[model samples]
Target chain A: METVILMLGWVGVFAPVALGVIGSTIGCSRAGMSACGAMLDTESGYGKFVGISAMPSTQAVLGIVVMFTLNREINTLNAPGIFGVGILTGIALMLSAIHQGNSVASAINASKNKPEIFGLSIAPAAIVEGFAVFVFVFALVVSGAIPQ
Target chain B: MNSDQYITLMSALPSLGKTYHVDIPPISRFQLEKRLNLLTEEHQALLSDIESVLHWDHLNSHYDDSELIQSATLVLEQLTHKHYDTLREMILWRLNLRTILAGLRYRQRGDELNHQQSHWGVGDMEAHIETYWQHPYFNLQSRFHWIASVQESLQKNDTMQVERILFDVTWQYLQRCSSQHYFDFTAVVTYVLRWNLVSRWSSYDADKGVEHFQSLMAFALGEYQQLSMGIVVDQNGDSK
Candidate 1:
């Protein structure tokens, strides 16, 4: 049982980065495909489209930070707290990243046609990024409370 | 189809403004065809099947009502068997609208509802239409308010008005479907359909028509000059 808990603690410590990487991979590809396609239709503004496609990559960075914060000596006492916070934060980050990718793709598509709305169109993606940040901050705060 | 593939394919297409509002299509036919080449073979086949039933040119041929219904039924069955629920639904709705318009036309011509006509309608409302053939709007006006307007336009003998109303309704329906489907195969299909609508309306522009006519005339004159020169050369060759 102790071995199982320790294994889980290691898994939890790694989960945020793993899941966040997966999410970021999918999200970036999704938005990147859109950006590449939009480039075909437009004469200029290629830089902004490329920039939007990179928006989902932030989640991966946040996940890496969370993983580092959660990295410490594993034990039965700390395992459960780390496992719970780590896994939940990972899931939240993953979902937010994926959805943010979709939002970014939509924003790129819209603003490509109506250049005037370029700033406003990215608001949804920013909102999604905010949610991911919330998960990152709370996970950090909560991981500190885990028995060391 | 890969979701990313669809996102890319659709993003590459420029937005088609409101149907009938644009003086010309945002994208030319050549560019549209180039972009459509991005679709996978399977999706391309699926799009062709869907267009057969919904595109005006395909159905505007000299086919009778029964043949048209049969073709639509076969296509609908194929779409259903392939689990293309959205496409099947859109085609079904379009067929129903066609049936309503045909029924309205027949009634206007003073032709009594023929009992033997099983091929008249093609959707859930077909039975309702048969039962309510004597009623203007086929008793389905409450469900489809636009039917009344279509009937009124028909009465006025305003073909353009009828086409305009039908185009608007179809555009709105496509827009609704598009909302539910973003960055997917369905969205791509809806965009093509909307583009067709805009193209059709743009074709009605009198100025464009005159320009097209002038271009045709110039081409014809050029061809005639070439033919005359060829004939003169042939005569000279014979004399030699």
Candidate 2:
């Protein structure tokens, strides 16, 4: 039972980074493909499309930070807390990144034609990112309460 | 269904604005065909099936009503088997339009309603249309108000007005569907359909213009020849 708990602790510690990376990869690829497509239609503003494609990468960075914060000596006492917080945070981050990527892709598509609305188009993506930040910050706060 | 497979393709397609508002499609036929090459082989086949059923040229008038219904039924079955809900809905919409319009034309010509002729339409509304054949708008004015105007225009023998109303209604319907879908197969389909709308409209205009110009030229030339003949006849009379 002790060994199982410790193993779970390690899995939890790594889960955020692994899941976050996977999510970011999917999100970035979706948005990047859309950006590449939009580039074919427009004459200028290629830079902005490329920039929008990178929006999903922030979740990966946040995941790395959460992993480091949770990386302490794992024991039976802290295992459950770490497991719960890490897994939940990872799921939230992953979902948010995926949906944010969809928003970014839509933004890029819309703005490619009507350049005047570029800023407004990205607002939805920014809102999705905000949800991810909420999960990241709360996960860190909860991790501090776990037993050393 | 996951639309991720088509994100790039859908995004790459240029927006086709409102049919009446646009003078020409933003992309040329050659450019559009080139972009369509990005679709997968399976998707290409599916799209070809869709076009074969709905495209103006493919729906030849010479094909009797029964033949069109057979082909449309087969295509609808294929779309259903593939689980293409949007495409199926679009095709059904078109079939409904054809049924309603055919009913109107038949009624306009004072033909008796023939319920036995099931080949007139391919969908569930055939019975309803036959039942309401004597109604001015086939009793569809409550649901499709535009049918009333179309019927009125047809009665007046204003073919151009009827065409305009049909184009506008079709354009708006496709536009509404397009807005609900993005980065998906439905979006691509709607875009292509709208492109066809624009191309057809422009060509129709051009053809009408050429027809008018030819008629005007014929009248003017006829008047000139008549005057010339009269002048020669008068001159010969004076000489004699």
Candidate 3:
């Protein structure tokens, strides 16, 4: 019974990455293209916007790494706090990555008619980032590693 | 037509649908000269400071807010041209190199515009004003597209108009990056993200430029050294 359960946990760990990438990649691509496309008429001062969209992927990458750590920890003994960390971090990571698309969409809308005030568009993306920060903090609590 | 006529046309509107005109204040010579004086003084101090912090050939637009940079550049134009003969030739020489560098900036990427034209000829405020209005890229297109749109807005003015265009275009660029429309990416970038492959990689890089971005920064910084009094610190007050 334990052996089968361990096997299932392993699959669960990797599956989110595979599925998340598949499910989110196209949508993310769409949102990003729309945001950058808003500057079709003007190309100056756009590097900042393009720069942030590139950053949201870190959420996805962290989620994948967390999953592997989860699978290994779960097989060892199911330390309850680790499981909580796994689930919460997973939820936070997925949610942040998905929510970033909304900011991307809003940024596109704002870009077209008001290029000068585009810095304000970062507000939404920053809010979505709170979840990622939470995950990082919680992951640290569960792992409890001291700096060398 | 001369620059005044061009300025008048730019500040007008697209009456017939194709040709456009932008509007500006009907400044008498005295008023133009006064405003020009204030603009010049403000920029000299700022540029002098910038030269202290940032190195030439390593500038980036995002380092300084575009709003701050644009206003500074406009001021610099006024200072270098208006009453410039009253100052040292060295200042004008520095201004010339700065302008050329600013031109390459696409808008202050490296804290330097790639338009070093101050030394190219002898001129007062009027000539530089004329030159500014005469340039097809900054004058005809940018003013017509960005300035006119903001001017049409009930509450917008010249400064507001520039800000509006910059924000609108920048926001759109963000959207295009999110969506991954390859063509749109090409269209929305400065020289750094000009190619599709660069866009592909930049979509996820910590910084947006991929590889060419570094090269672009180098170009802008190189120009800053000419006008800035000393080594210019980047906006962050960090050495590059």
Candidate 4:
């Protein structure tokens, strides 16, 4: 049933959001004491990058919430590419979260070399997060204002 | 004329302004000269009053002269110049000693660490520290370049990072102390601020913890000043 497909898409989106949060949390912990002070040393050198890497996690949480509410309406819709978007977007949202965690880890590593320029390391990692933010925005468009 | 004016005119003595000083002396010429004269009279009066108390050595005294120390023993010898050079030279000399000693201590610890068990090895550690500390004699840009490099490397997930910053600084002459000072101040501030913003430091709400952040920034400024070369900020935040 179309309803089953939408429910399935919603489940897929939720899974990646959880995974991304888990990944970032793990990466942040491994990032040691960085930016927060005392917990990480300038000696460790990865604190600033870790600080930036840690921000994208909010996007993952945002994706899960949006996709869950839209799933029921998605089943009712019969528009072009609507169902396909639900499926593809669900997948992209999850991967986007994962991509963010990887990028966060990369940014944290960059902080190790340049501790003072934490902002620079954070900017690139934000690009990876752009994908998730973009996917979320696209899902809203595809859902056609949720017909509410 | 006021001592401030006299000091200013003396300071701007046509040939003296050739020095690459980044700032105009704080006092106006009228005020400078007045202050200088007042200081001279005070010097004479103090000496006349201290004929009985003049046995202590300024350089070897128990007191620390962190504030405005310039030696003037030669001038102090000139009944008019008594002890001015002693103070002038003392300030100049102590600053050099502090810079050198700090550099040396950093170098010695670095040598010991490399010879011990560092993954960076001795030569690389030596090279890295040499590079970090070989900083420009007088530009904040070059210094920021060094700071940015350290920040960038950490973001990229480079390994054995602590050693890299240490070595980078070590290469320059170990002038900056490598002992982690953030921990000393941040712990106290974080606890007092109550906002963790992160998983570990997540206990305090941001609104409740802003004071802590301010304190942390303040502390970092102190650390940065001590580590940088040739940049001097006085108590009132005037940079020289």
Candidate 5:
């Protein structure tokens, strides 16, 4: 029972990093594909696409920070709480990153054709990022309630 | 060609078409020359090909109405052919429909369908149009029911009614395609088609132009709905 609890606790601590990285990897690749396509269409706006493609990478960094914060002494009493918080938060970050990446890809595609809409087009991606931030902040807040 | 990039290119087409729209009546030779100059070098080359065939300078000076109409018809045929080679399948269908209509009209008037000048530059359709008209294999009959309807108009000898029916059929086809593939390149192609129709109708009747523009807005709404749904599927039907 002790070994099982410790294993669950460890899974909790590392879950955010693993899931976040997976999400970011997929997200960045999706956005990067669009950026590459945008570069082919226009001559001067390559920088914007490259920059937008990096948006999804933020979730991975957020995940890393959450994992570090969740790291603490593991026991049967708090293992379930830690596992629940960490796994759920990781899932949220992962899904948000994936969706945000899609939004950024669309922005890059739209702006490449009409450069005048570059700033406005980023609104959708930024809004998606806002949701990720909410999840990140809420996870940090809720993780504090779990007993060490 | 990612699906997103195709959609982006398509979304830009309406603005591009708007740039080509002219509001003035009886466009002057000077205005036409100026417009040609405004286009990119590639577009200018394409337009020059038509001008060379028409000898526009001589035609403009002579002001022969029948000759001008003939030249315009030839120019449309040439451009239609060129666009078929460059544009997507959806747009090629629209071009084919226009050619089919022109062929029907020519047949009704007992004009020589085999003449090179009368051809719309569609693949084998220019040569085998009569066979296709009579037999219409390969689902062409269902795809283009307008052919038979136009034949009825031909019997009545109502050229205006035939044109109206063709325009309606083309508009409905565009609307259907746009709604069915709202997230794909079809939506953008629909916009360009709508703009082209609006410009054509407006040149003839301002009320018709306004009506088509309203329909274009409806199609644009469908595009907006697809975007809001966030169903990002590529050309291969892979979702992100």
Candidate 6:
């Protein structure tokens, strides 16, 4: 039972990092494909596509931070709390990254043809990022409540 | 199709919105030349057609107004069909609408539909209009009904009003597609269609060009609202 609890704690500590990285990887690649396509259409504004493609990488970094924060000794009382928070937060970040990637891809596509809409097109992606931030903050605040 | 591929094709399209001006005289040689220069070499045939029309007008200085209108319509229809494959399917829909209108006019004049002057390359609605009107599909049936409602105006030979109705239907269809496929190729297709309509309207009547453009812009805003709501989903169940 003690070993199981300790294993559960380890799972909790690494879940966010694993899930977040997977999400970011998929997200970044999707956005990167769109950015590559945009480059073929426009002579300038390549920088914007590159920058938008990197947006999903932030979720992975946030996941790493959360994992570190939860990386203390494992116990039955705290194990479930860490496990729940880590898994839930990881899922939120993953979904947010994937969806945000799609939004950024759309922005890149739109702006490639009409450069004037560049700023306006990114608005949707930014809104999607906001949701990820909320999850990140919530996980951090709630993780502190678990008995160490 | 990929978003980038769609954007690349869209970027290749000429921006006629910038070239068309409400204050400019319609069909001036200089204006036509400017428009021709903006197009790629593939559209050289369209330029030649326009030149021929101008030459005919010059030779027959006393040409009747109806004759001039007919010639102009022929030139536009030919141009629309010239690069049919290169354009999006949405454009084919517009061309088909024009062909259908022409067919209606011919029928009202007691002329055979097969004797219509203009020929749409592919996706010609006239070729299968009977099937479209009688098809069991709900969407096709609805479209047929909508078009059928315009028969009264067609009977009266209100060509301008009929054309306006067709434009409205085309634009609304494009708007719906753009909204439903916000992150797909449809968005770019919608933009190009709007640009085409604006260019066509400006050339047809400079006085009403700006007003028509404003209405299109308003419609575009509504499309953008639909896009932002993330209600758009691809046919494959993907939220684009």
Native contacts kept, each candidate: 0.77, 0.59, 0.00, 0.00, 0.00, 0.15
* Per-prediction TM-score: 0.87, 0.89, 0.33, 0.30, 0.49, 0.53
Winner by lDDT: 1
Q: In model 2 chain A, which range of ten residues has the least summed lDDT?
A: A35-44
Residue-wise C-alpha lDDT for candidate 2, range B199-226, written one tens digit per residue: 8776666678889777766666787866
lDDT of 4 by residue, B28-76 (tens): 3454234234234654354333221221222332333322121222223
All candidates in order of DockQ, best leading = 1, 2, 6, 5, 3, 4
- State residue B97's C-alpha deviation in candidate 4, in Å: 47
The window of 10 residues in a row where model 5 chain A has the poorest summed lDDT is: A34-43
| Ten contiguous residues minimizing lDDT sum, candidate 1 chain A | A80-89
Between candidates 1 and 4, the one scoring higher on TM-score is: 1
Measured against the true two-chain complex, the DockQ scores of the candidates, in the order shown, are: 0.66, 0.61, 0.01, 0.00, 0.04, 0.10
The list of candidate 2 runs beyond 4 A from truth reads: B59-61, B114-118, B206-240
In model 3, what lDDT does residue B130 have? 40
Which candidate achieves the best TM-score against the true structure?
Answer: 2
lDDT of 2 at A92: 85
DockQ of 1: 0.66
Q: Give the Cα error of residue B2 in candidate 5, in Å.
A: 9.9
Overall lDDT per candidate, in order of appearance: 0.86, 0.84, 0.43, 0.40, 0.65, 0.64
TM-score of 6: 0.53
- Which candidate gets the maximum DockQ versus the true structure? 1
Tens-digit per-residue lDDT, A10-83, candidate 4: 55435445544554454344323233321222344334443564565665576566556454533434322344
TM-score leaderboard ranking: 2, 1, 6, 5, 3, 4
How many steric clashes between backbone atoms does each model show? 0, 0, 82, 91, 0, 0
RMSD (Cα, Å) of model 2: 5.7
Candidate 1 at residue A31, lDDT? 93
- Model 3 misses residue A65 by how many Å? 4.3
